[model samples]
Each structure stands twice: as C-alpha cells, then as structure tokens.
Target: MTKKTQTPAVQKGNTDPNTLQLHKDPAQTDAAQIAAMALGSVAANAMTARSFAKGTFGTLDVTECVMTLKQRVDTTHGGDLKHAETTLTAQAATLDAIFNEMARRAALNMGEYLDATERYMRLALKAQGQCRATLETLAAIKNPPIVFARQANIAHGPQQINNEAISGTTTTRARKTRTRQNELLEEPQHGSTQLDDRTTPASARGHTAVEAVEPIHRTTKRRRESSGGA
Candidate 1:
C-alpha cells in the first residue's frame, strides 16, 4: 500500500510537452489561480461598507448583530472604509477609556447607548409638555376674562362618591333631632302668684267675723211673724 499525495503541475525540469502531455503555457496555472482568488474575494465581500453603514445607521441593534469585516468593500486600493476605519481606530484609545469607565460603573455595551436614547426621548416629551402648558397659560393670561380650561375633577376613590348629598342630609337630620330633644327638655312656665298667711288665726280661720254677726237681725224678724200668725 502507498500513501497518496497531491502533486504540483509538470516539474520545472521536465521538457516533453507532447510526449508527457504536460500543459503548454504554464502561466495558465498562475492565471487560473489568480482568477479564482479574485472571484472568491468578490463573492466574500459583495455587501459594501457603505451599505452596511446605512443598514446600521442610527439603529440600536445588538453588538453581536453589527456589521462584519467581510461586509466591507473589497479593493486593492483602500477606499473611504480605510480612511474612516483608520480615523476611528486612531481614536480607539479614547473610546477604550470611555468603555472602561462605563464598565467600572457596571454598564453593558449596548445598554449605555440605549439608556442615552431613552433619556433623550423622555426629556423631549417632558419639554414638550412643559411648552404646551406654558403656551396654554400665556394664552389664558392674554385674554381679558382669562378663561382657562377646567381641570378634570379626578376622584381618587370612593371619598367623593355620593358623599356630598348624603353627608348634607345626614347633618341636617342630626341637627333637627338635636333641636327636638332640646325643645322637649325646655318646658314653659305658667302664671304664678305669691302669698303669705301671717295674719290668719289657726282656729277661727274657717268663718269670717262678718258672717257671725249676720244672725241677730234674722231672729227678730222671725219673732214678729210668729205673733201675727197667733
């Protein structure tokens, strides 16, 4: 058994092109190889760097999903990608310092970008609301009567639900009950007289002195009537 191995084209010393059936114009091998390399490179880098940049511009895609090196344009003469990349790499020290500081503070690579974007959005919304409120207030101040939009009476819970009418009725009934109870406790006084028994005797108080003297005249009249009848 023999070990198999790959062999290069006709050796440099071999000289029989027709008899050995070796290839003519040996430069074809080099040209074919160069062509294969060129086509492979082109196929590898079909998406230009500019296209990748546009795809990723202002978008918050994850780091793992970012553009790849092969996505950059393939060229013997370096283009904008070379310059832009060189410039960016030149400042990589500063970027690395920023990244280190952020990491020390426990920041994720994509989290910083996303956090800044979200913060900006929130601030923008807050500023918009403030501007709107300011405009409304200024408009109100300019008018003579200064009519302002009424704020909605947002009831937080059951505190104000049917509370006003019910509370008023309960209060009124309580007051009326208190008034009736007070009137019952407060009685009116009738007319009153003041008297003293200081001058009256204990025994003769039953008959007055004028009533005792009235019997004398009645007895004389009765005696004259009896004589006339005899």
Candidate 2:
C-alpha cells in the first residue's frame, strides 16, 4: 500500500502570500518600444493611403491607387508648379475658343437685328475680356514680376550709413559731415561764408557777401562831373 503526500494550504485572509521576481534588460526594452512605435506609424500611413485612394479613384484599382499616391508625392516635390503651367495653357486655349464662338454669334445676330442681339454682343464682350484675362494670367505665370526692395531710415538723430553699394561699384563713399546748422555756423573753404566776422571784411566773401550799396543818382552825378571836367 502507498500513501499520498498532503500539501499545506494558506488562509484566504493571509497578507504574506508568494511572490516571484524577474530582471529586465534595458537594451531589449528600448528596442521593443522603438519597434512598437514604428509599427504604429506604418499603420497610420496605411489608413491614410487607403482613404486617399478610395476618395480619388472610387475603386481601389492598383494603377489608380499608385497614381494617386504619386500625385501626392509629386505635390510634395513641387511638381504642381509644372502642372499649373500646362493647365493654364489649356485654359487659355479654351477661353480663346469660347471668345471666337461668342463673337461669331454676336456678328450674325447683329445682321438679323433680333431682340437678343444686344445680349449676344454683351456676352461676346464678356468672353473677350475673359480670354484676355486668361492670356494675361498665363503671361504672368511664365514671367513673374520682379520685386525691388529698398531700405530707408527715418529719424531725427545722426544720419544713417549704408554699407551696400549705391550703383554697382564696391568703392566706399565719403562720409557726409555737413548739415544745415553746420553750414550756417562754419566758414566754407570754396563758397562765401554766411557768418560775418571782425577779422574778415564782407567784401572778401565774394559776390554772395552782404554789403550796403551807394545811391544810383549820386553815382550818376559823380560820373557826369568827371566827364565834364575831362
């Protein structure tokens, strides 16, 4: 006869039960987090691609799906600019056709002198304007306008100096040291000085100097006397 072994059992309300410990690897934990993030990103992109493909192509055809994705990629890569050029060109041609048809109907209606003749002429003019606008838009797209930016300084303090070349030369310009107050107070080297001094006579300041003039009649009488005596 064999006897069975009996195991001990703990009470239901026991606070100290059993516990197991495990060590974690830092490198493995980091790698696992990175993998999870990558998968989540892939799932998000798949959802986006599916939505775009469904909306654009209506059916998930492989060619159309790829084309739709390619369009998005092209837009990101600035391919829309080239697309715009061709689209505008086509629009301009369409507008020209519309203008011609409208003008022909207007001419025929004018000869008939019908009640809608004025309306036809009006529509023709409108189409002509629209065609002109389309052509102008195409021209603008082909040749963009050049923008000129100039820096200007406005203040009451000392004059501002610019380091940039005025025309195209790299030569530095002479500093401007003269102002309105300086001109009025300082004596000039070339022209007449505005300020009068005791050392320099007013006549020495050139034709611009201020001085009293003799009376015209007295000078004429003196000239006559000198002529008579001669």
- Name the top lDDT candidate: 2
lDDT tens readout by residue for model 2, 11-76: 553232121111345657866755653465443454466667677655443333444545755684
Q: Write model 1 residue lDDT over 100-137, tens digit each, in one string.
A: 45444443324667766555555545544554555454
lDDT of each: 0.46, 0.60
- Each candidate structure's TM-score, on Cα atoms with residue i matched to residue i, is 0.17, 0.39
Q: Clash totals for all models, in order?
A: 0, 0
Show the lowest summed lDDT stretch of 10 residues, model 2.
Answer: 14-23
Tally clashing residue pairs in candidate 1.
0
> What TM-score quantifies how close candidate 1 is to the native fold?
0.17
- Reference-based lDDT, residue 165, model 1: 25
What C-alpha RMSD separates each model from the true structure? 29.0, 20.3
TM-score: which candidate is best? 2
